[model samples]
Target: MIDILLVPIVLVIILVMLHSYFGMEILKRGIIFTDLAIAQFAALGSSISLGYFHEEHFYLLTLSFALFSAFLIAFASTRKLHLEAFIGILYVLGASGIMMVLSHSAEGMEHFKSLLASDILFTPPMEVAKSAVIYAFIAIALYFIYPKLSGFLKELLFFSLLAITVTSSVSLAGVFVVFVLLIAPPFVALSLNFKKPLLGSFIFGWFFSISAITISYFYDLPTGYSVVFLGAFLTALVVLAASKKALEN
Candidate 1:
């Protein structure tokens, strides 16, 4: 059981670091909603594909759908209308379509529940391996592209990373905890005035994630919710301390 949990926890930490980096980039660029929107779109696409595809094909279907969602968002960002508004509309439409598709299928509720909240504890070993491979691809892609990604390309990369991170995280931590992973570490790092922001964010993410998992293991609390609460609490304490230090200075 410890070994099983350890692998997923390590994967979650790597994902959290990638998520924090791109999330901060998105926040800086004022495209926060882009992540949520693309994630919903990917979820809808994956949920729909599951109706016709086997479990083995699920990751491929999800990756295709996620990439398509990224393309659509990137295209829309270049148009005259507000990207945020467009993303909102796309989210609603995609989400509604997914619900409609699921309504006609026998496994609808099961798939929907998985898409909505995820069940990391029940994740199969094969699926864990698959997720790790996907994370590897994402990490490598980001590493190579980081140098060339600038201007609109940087934003595009942000959208892509957000989509991948959100989808992967939603499969484990759910959307709420995904949001926590995206936001909390940066908050902690910023409040602490860390010199190396990326390193600081990564440290905070790992600390909060491990703490949350420990709390969930010892107590009966939901892992995802525990993570969010612990992250928020830590961020608040860091900010408060920072504020006090500033006042003293």
Candidate 2:
């Protein structure tokens, strides 16, 4: 059990640390669904690669589509339009596009389910290491380059980095897993007004993710969806309870 879970535990910890930062920033911008839209687009690219090309060019296509979505969202951010609504529309379009692409594939439904959430318990060690390297580079950029940018350039860089992150994460953990990791723990930390919200997010994310992994291992449940379910369910309960208390007080 220890050997089996060690890689996954490390992967989840890395995911939570990186995603919590973006999740906090996304919440601050009040564009909650931007990550979802970008993730959907990335999934669309993967679907295209699977359906038409037999999974060749998967990374290239996924990164390309994710970057495309990021560019559109960044542009919309500078416009006078309803940004959230626009992002919602982009999400739907990517979703519908994915369905259309995969409609003819024999493994269409299975592929779709995997896109939504994969069995991260069986994730490859090499893949985890690769993603970690990519994330490290992204973190360096965010620390140095991101702080110096302003205006539309800043928005583009931010979303582009997010797209890159989602592209890798979507392939590894699936879309809903990425979304939850990007939102849930951060949402809880922000709602509770934690001083070091990122640290709080890491704690919450690690708690739910590790707990879910343990439960899934013992119960023979799907690991990715287990994480998604526990993260979402627990975060929603916490936020709702907090909101109710705030309203009362």
Residue 49's lDDT within candidate 2 is 93
- Candidate 2, residues 177-212, lDDT tens digits: the string is 999999999999988989999999999999999999
Cα displacement (angstroms), candidate 2, residue 101, comes to 0.6
Candidate 1: where are CA atoms >4 Å away?
Answer: 52-56, 104-107, 149-154, 232-249
Return the clash pairs for model 2, or none.
none
Residue pairs with backbone overlap in model 1: none
Candidate 2 global lDDT = 0.96
lDDT of 1 by residue, 149-220 (tens): 776676567567667766776666565567777777776776677898778989889988877777777676
Candidate 1 positional error at 202, Å: 1.4
Candidate 1 CA-lDDT value: 0.72
Each prediction's RMSD over C-alphas, in Å, is: 4.1, 1.6
In candidate 2 the C-alpha lDDT for residue 120 amounts to: 90
Residue 85 in model 2: lDDT = 99
lDDT of 1 at 129: 76
TM-score on alpha carbons, each prediction: 0.79, 0.98
